[model samples]
Target: MTEPTGLGMSKVARILMVEDDEDDYILTSDSLEQLDSYQFDIHWVTNPKVAVEKLSQEEFDICLLDFQLGAQSGLDVLRQAIKLGCMTPIIMLTGQDDDNLDKLAQDAGAVDYINKEDISTGRFARAIRYALARNEVASERLERLKAETQNRSKDRFLAHLSHELRTPLTSILGYTELLLQGEKAKESRSELNIILSNGKHLLSLLNDVLDLSKIAADKLELNPSEINLDSFIADVFYLLQINAQDKGLSLVITAPQALPERIRADSTRLRQILINLSYNAIKFTDHGQVAIKLWTEWVEQKELLFFEVADTGIGIPAERLASIFKPFEQVEDIVTRKEGGAGLGLAICTELARRMGGELSVESELGKGSRFRFAIEPGDISDVPRSELHFVKADTNQDNEHYDPLQGRVLVVDDAPDIRQLVQKICDGFGLQVVTAENGLQAVQMCNESLSLDTPFTLVLMDIHMPVLGGRQAIAQIREAGFTAPVIALTAAALKGVKRSLVDIGFSDVLHKPINKKALYQCMSMHLAAQESGEQIDEVEPHILLVEDDVDAAEVSKMLLESLGAKVTLAFTGAECLAVLQSSLPVCKILLDLHLPDTDGLSLAAQIRTISPELEIVVVSGAQIEASQLSALNISRSLLKPLNLSTLQSLID
Candidate 1:
């Protein structure tokens, strides 16, 4: 701990006096002693160098220095002490009353200039008190500035680290997706699916941790929009349906018909809060169900919608409930440890809700499960514009998707070989001949060369950070030279204001790293003339063998698949699955469940694979599925319980 240096308190002042004359020192000490406001402890140092050392190293309330130190300069001592980072209050004592000398003394780092001839208790004490007080204020400001500098450094470090992490992850996820989207996707997709799933999971974990860091620093930013309540609730339920199914639990949502259709809020953050809370509920609960209920409460003339996520899981004990919302806090139990989390879900959820003009509260019985609730003001229908539709469904039907012919080639620029090649592959798939550049410097040169030859590149996918030249500077050079092709920034940095800043700095658009293939395609298509959208083809009805233990859930899922035009054959038990596979039914895919009353789900999968080695098997269960388990059973991929129809349709079709 740092020692207190009499920071304006009614206490004894520790003073250091550097004066060669014994008579002057005695006179100055007597003046300070006559002050009724303070007691003084004076230490005398005659040597200028010693005075400098003492001021620099010792903790004192104030220092009194003589202008002339017999053959040494008092000004030299003050300069040296200040240079050495002294925080003590320093007052220069002078025999001469020259205005120039007083100004010089004050400018040389002294808090005040006091004349020896005008030595009086009141005047000396006034100067001493003011110096001490100003010094304390300066010290506090310095500390605060140092703290701010450290925080900025920390944010920069996180950004750099995020970039480094996302670089390799981009390669991993990029190649995995490419392979999955390839002609031989049927052959290697199962193994690649593991890599893709885990890679995305790791990304989510990274984002969650980064969110905590930003929130702790009070820098977490929210982008609010007029969101359709219908879509928001559907998405939350769709995302977490798997978690509920992993343990044979029902994930349900109940909202009144009178519920508002739209709300002005940060939909992404709101979704994150619900997902985290509901996932936490599923993690702690061993059986039963997780339900999301919505109602309205009007208070103070404002319409507030109350959302409750209740689960029949092992609930929190009363004492520990308070700390459960704290970062890195978790209930100490075998289930919690085994379920595995960084104990950040609930903490982040509660904070997110509070930050969004709402408060999250929870109630639980130790063994009966928990109910998490929060409320937010719902906006009226006028919040959403007519042009803005609430639900815009994507054409997941690959058969109906088509691309037009490309009119020009693209330039793929990146320092990473993996990314450049990955993008090249994607561009090639888009039926556009692609050129490559290692950095922005190379990109600028190639772009100019192409333009000079009357064959300028159509679009430039530029990496932000490169060795020879960074994307921002290079793009500026390109734009200055009159190259007007759309140059999209491919970066790993997702720092706040990055996109807008990039746009301001000449980038046409921004495509973040750990490259989402779909997002990249969309971004590219917006600028480049897309050659061919997937042409409409005759629909191929997938013959699926869905083996689920819950008959009701299975029936609902089967109907959804059939509605998507799939010929679904449902099996309630593992034995029933084998019997179907043994029959001459053209079963292209099998959605297997790990939990079944008759036999082990894994054993059943192994049996089916042995009977028909070419048949694709997908696991649908509530428990966490491991890569090793999938590899062992020759399982293509595992879908979490309560499958979203679009995701299921895309997988089967």
Candidate 2:
């Protein structure tokens, strides 16, 4: 048999020939040496025992075994090699009439079985080359799979650890806020502030870790809404003002005076993307200004809103700009080690921009600074009545003192005793009449009794999942009974389904579990205004109709939504969707899965629009939906699975 060239040029591939006959062994070796490109060094063994011994001592690239080797068959040697994890490819040579031996050789781990009478130089060489190439490809695939599994395990562990850390961190922040507000000792006050600040910083790090995990898993979601460009930029400036001030840098924002007030985008994600870019800009710029410029351009009938964050800092080298966006990659190795970051900010921003149907690019010079620009298509901006913009701004104190609304009744319901006590203490500290319930049933009973006494509950803090009668069920019953109090679902379950179910079950609002003190106060203050107005609050929970064809996944997701208190109607196909729309349940939002066996998601969304053009539709797909398709469908939001609970909550909120 002829050996192939290029196969053994580097470290010559060793081959073991196991044959009992001396004549056959010499002939095989002569044939291999005579080939034009044959470079392998052949080791001839007269017995199977000697061949096995050589295999144990040497690493051969390929093995050629004769079917007949005295009493010891080639099959025996092949089995022994396989048992020892010998991955070398083996080719078995057999007599033309020895069909049984050829079959047995293959069953024992020989890669290929060839007949000696039929073997030619061309066929023999081609077979060897094919075997080696196949082995290499298999090895590569195995290595890749191993690496992927390791990464996934690490991600899962981090996610679980972060979740555990959040629980106590929430309590620490809660107690610290109380101490900071109450009449604590002066010395203790300063220490509490330090504690609060450190806690907040740690919380931010934890959030970053969670966000990174979500991005890696492709579970990060965007909740796009129409945002006023001027107002949005103003808010961003307000948020970054402190950072810029600390660095003694000038930060400027410039936009057209009459620029479109509304652009369709995910506000939180947009804020995150901008914050990362702006902070980097400010961090690097020690002496110069960091300017953010916004403009709108119409390119080929698409309205692209462009933003540029230009900083006059120590800029990146021209050659390193491309590599800067890679995860854990920075301009220089020392820059990352000194600057203290996972070097993932830019990478995350780039990915977020891509998900928002835009591209993020940068231009910089070594001595000057860098300019990072990204653009997203402008969303539909309908005229909002002037009256809706009239919101009362809370008074700010020079001392950053907490504002406590006096003598209000507050109800707190939660499964965790620590969380219940925490809420009660905060409310009592505010001088409010606080009532506590361990579960939803007690909460409902208290609400009913308060109504009878003509001192109806001012507000109800209901936990989503309780021992008897969950938050959603209790809220629905209370609302059905004409109780006008604002019921907020306080839940620790951050899953999308849980939040959606809470909203669906007719709660006034949802505050994610492990509640933030500031967020709780804000909710209370807003609801109190509604209570004073004496307006009969309508139980108008947003309706989200999920259209998906995968039965098992759909059922599980539906249950999750129900847990979140969302009234969900599932349609397995486009035909089902059309039928549902015909029946007349007004849907506030629709979650459309793109790939369906019966009909496509995009087509279903279009059909829904034909019925109710104003219906909010969120496209759900396993694959990334292109910008072109989103524009064509007029889809405001797109969620990729496994879906993020926070993104879904933001959309409904």
Candidate 3:
């Protein structure tokens, strides 16, 4: 053949021959001899023991093992060689015809199984070439998996460090601000302000790094909902207008007439992107306006939401524009010198845009202005025409911080002493009496103890993570204990989508840690005002236990009961039903099916009453039920299957 073939590689190919018969070794050598592109060095060993010793050294690239060996088979040598850290590729050879031997040979770590009768020049050469190619691919895959695992470990370490850093920063910033509020030591006020400002900047940077870590680890999730564009855009402008106005810069909002009025997106993430970009524009501009405009682009048949933040501030130079969006990379110019930043805003915004099925790009002219554009495929869009809107500056705050103090009692739960005292001081300013608990278990006990005295907390501020008991479980127990006051979660966990999780776990509202007094005050005021006006959460649904052997029938009955506003638990056997009762859960009634798999339904009723005498038991079945039998067991009622909605409704009532 021409230059070379696969078996005739450029380098010398080392082959190990493990054969008891000398004739087979010669035939194997002759077949490989057909390819002459490179030299082939074959090491022959007639003893299986000697073959294993040579193979263990890994000095050969490939091994050819014959199935027929004296006393011991070649498969044993192959397996032993593999067990001793051998990486050499192996091909099993047999002299006789046997169908099952091929599978057995391959199963014992041989790369291929070949018959000596089929040892043609081309076939034998191709078999050796395929084995080597496969080994190379497998080695490459192992390295890739190792790299990915290391990356994940690094991400986790970064996240833990960020969280640990925030805990101490919270107390430092909280106390500094509190001291400044009282006009304590007029001469030291400026120095205290400096500490507060720098602490906040550091906190902001920590948040940025943590967010990127979460995104990189694929831990960040998005929850999109329909939003009214008019209010959403107006709110963004209103929030930033004050910051812009303070610096003599204008915040402008504009939209093209063709833009849709409503779209589906995660409002929190969208707001974060808009705020970061617009705030940067404000911070950079000395005395010009930051304009945010919205439009749409048609890609194929789908419409994409296109928005731009154009600022008439100091523009980026041509050479630095390429690296401006890179994380931790800032365009080092006069403007950047005056307004220092972590340089993570644009990088984070770009990543979040991609997660929403879009991209972010920018254009700028030196000493003129910069324009940042973002386009996203909004999950859903409406055809309604958008109303024209313009930005107006938000009103400034008054100097004095005074309020009509609320008259009520509040319980604050936290593991940290500093946080507990800080919250107590804030609540004192509101004129609300305060109670504190170091952990969730203690908080539940305090609430129960207070209830016995005819005095209970008007509101609860609970921390999410704690020792002994967690906030979620504590709140559940609080609810079980008949405490219906509004419970607000105080958390330091700032991961995206955490607020939704807290709310679903029965929290009325979520307040992030390194707490802002303004936000906390507003949340407390809103919740307390609602409580004062007799507006409370709806009554708890009555719990019912339904025991049925048929899974389909049990599910149907559970659904029907839930439709009538009752919480139903279904058990397919008497044992499961008994376990449920033993938990001491508040059950209003028990629905029993007369047909049984383990024991009679009526017999199970006797055990149910022993756990709770007040829990009424109702028997359900076809014409197999009789009223006289149910009355004998002190069972409440007897009803037929394919339940009547009215009868089920009466049971819960």
What TM-score does prediction 3 earn? 0.55
- In every candidate, how many clashes are there? 19, 14, 0
Per-residue error (Å), model 2, residue 13: 7.7
CA lDDT, every prediction? 0.78, 0.73, 0.78
Which of the numbered candidates is closest to the native, going by highest TM-score?
1
Q: Candidate 2 or 3, higher lDDT?
A: 3
Question: Model 3: runs farther than 4 Å from truth?
Answer: 1-115, 118-155, 176-193, 214-323, 326-329, 333-343, 351-361, 366-410, 428-432, 440-460, 467-489, 497-510, 516-653
State in Å the error of residue 380, model 2. 1.4
lDDT of 3 by residue, 187-206 (tens): 78768867876797688678
lDDT (tens digit, per residue) of candidate 1 on 1-653: 12334665355768899999999989988888777566778999999988988888888888999999988778899889999998787899999888998889889988888889878746877897787667667777777778867887988888888888888899988788767656767776667866876897788778887888878877688878887777677666766786689789999888653566667888878878787788788877888999988877776876677889999988888878788888888764422567677777777877788787678999988899899999775565435433322333332212234555455678999999988998888778778879999988898889888887766787889999898998877887788688877788999887666775566556778888877666777777767643234322222244688898776678899899888888887788987777555543457888888889899788887888788898888888877789998997678888887788877977766
Cα deviation at 414, candidate 3, in Å, is 2.5
Stretches of model 1 off by over 4 angstroms after superposition? 1-14, 19-49, 67-76, 79-87, 94-109, 187-191, 216-219, 224-235, 248-250, 256-267, 296-299, 331-339, 376-378, 382-406, 528-653
